[model samples]
Target: MGTQAIIRPTTSQTAPAQEQNFGDQFLHVFLQDGTPVAKLGCGGSHVLNAAAGQSISNNRWTPITVQYNLPVGKQGGSCMIEIATDNGTAQRLEEYVSHPVSEVT
Candidate 1:
């Protein structure tokens, strides 16, 4: 059995002020072959892929945590996914970011 965490903005009017127009930004995390994988999307486009051979065991219950630092003026934000098991070190599964872009006139 595997688990997944999907992080995305809610509806436009219902979303928080900071995320209203950025509803198209999303991050997906899931377990594959006992490993954690991630995919990032922005503006309805799949822009980043970090899923690879990162493995975790399915033998015991593990605690997973996701953290994010919201973007600041002209700077990007980042999200980190981690998993920890009893008597083991916490492992970082993935890190996704929303990079800043140049403005076009």
Candidate 2:
């Protein structure tokens, strides 16, 4: 079989305020091939990026399933998937918190 990237299942958790907007959630998976992967869902904090201080909402859930199709390597790219109740809202933060999912191998 051809070489492939072994993606580990990562689950983040957080508790957002009830008053906060638990909009739609999206994920961006960066591959070693310099490609980007995006997925849709819902949760608090909206954007799914690499943060030193961030957590996923345990009460919030998204109905989007993100898939990644890329090779495995030590050198990879970055990704940025925003979240919001409407796509238009997410568009506002797409430029910020760009998450980079690089292969540690």
Candidate 3:
């Protein structure tokens, strides 16, 4: 089974909490440390370098998609990410992750 979410960031982005929780998140997306990121199972972290903060942090709704490919046995995991910036620029990434997709996802 799969899951989906729609996030429309309000123009009110304040500093993220010093201790952001990724513990049980399947797809955790946030802008802490001035960088935009999307994390996977067990909240495996990855940078969404496609769009800059100014491009995404507005009242405009930028769409981002993340898909996980679970690991087999001892093999690692991978993810497919796509983002459409509010400005007509499109970004996509398909890469493997250092950690396996945690069931916690």
User: Which candidate should be chosen as best, given TM-score against the real structure?
Assistant: 3
Give per-residue CA lDDT, model 1, range 1-74, as digits (tens): 12323223232322211111234544555554455444444333424444334344434444443332223334
Error of 1 at 88 (Å): 6.9
Q: Model 3, stretches more than 4 Å misplaced?
A: 1-4, 14-25, 32-36, 41-54, 77-105
Candidate with more favorable, higher lDDT: 2 or 3: 3
lDDT of 3 by residue, 1-82 (tens): 2223344555555432112243533444565433345444433454333322344554444444433443333345555544
**What's the lDDT of the predicted structure labeled candidate 3?**
0.43
Give the runs in model 2 whose Cα sits over 4 Å from its true position.
1-72, 86-88, 91-105
lDDT of all predictions: 0.39, 0.27, 0.43
Give me candidate 2's TM-score against the actual structure: 0.22
What is the per-residue lDDT of model 2 for residues 34-90, given as tens digits with 9 covering 90 to 100?
212233222223334322112222334322222222222333222233323211123
Assess the local accuracy of residue 68 in candidate 3 as a C-alpha lDDT between 0 and 100. 40
Q: What is the TM-score of each candidate against the true structure?
A: 0.39, 0.22, 0.41
Q: RMSD (Cα, Å) of candidate 3?
A: 5.8
Badly placed stretches (over 4 Å) of model 1 are 1-22, 42-46, 51-54, 70-105
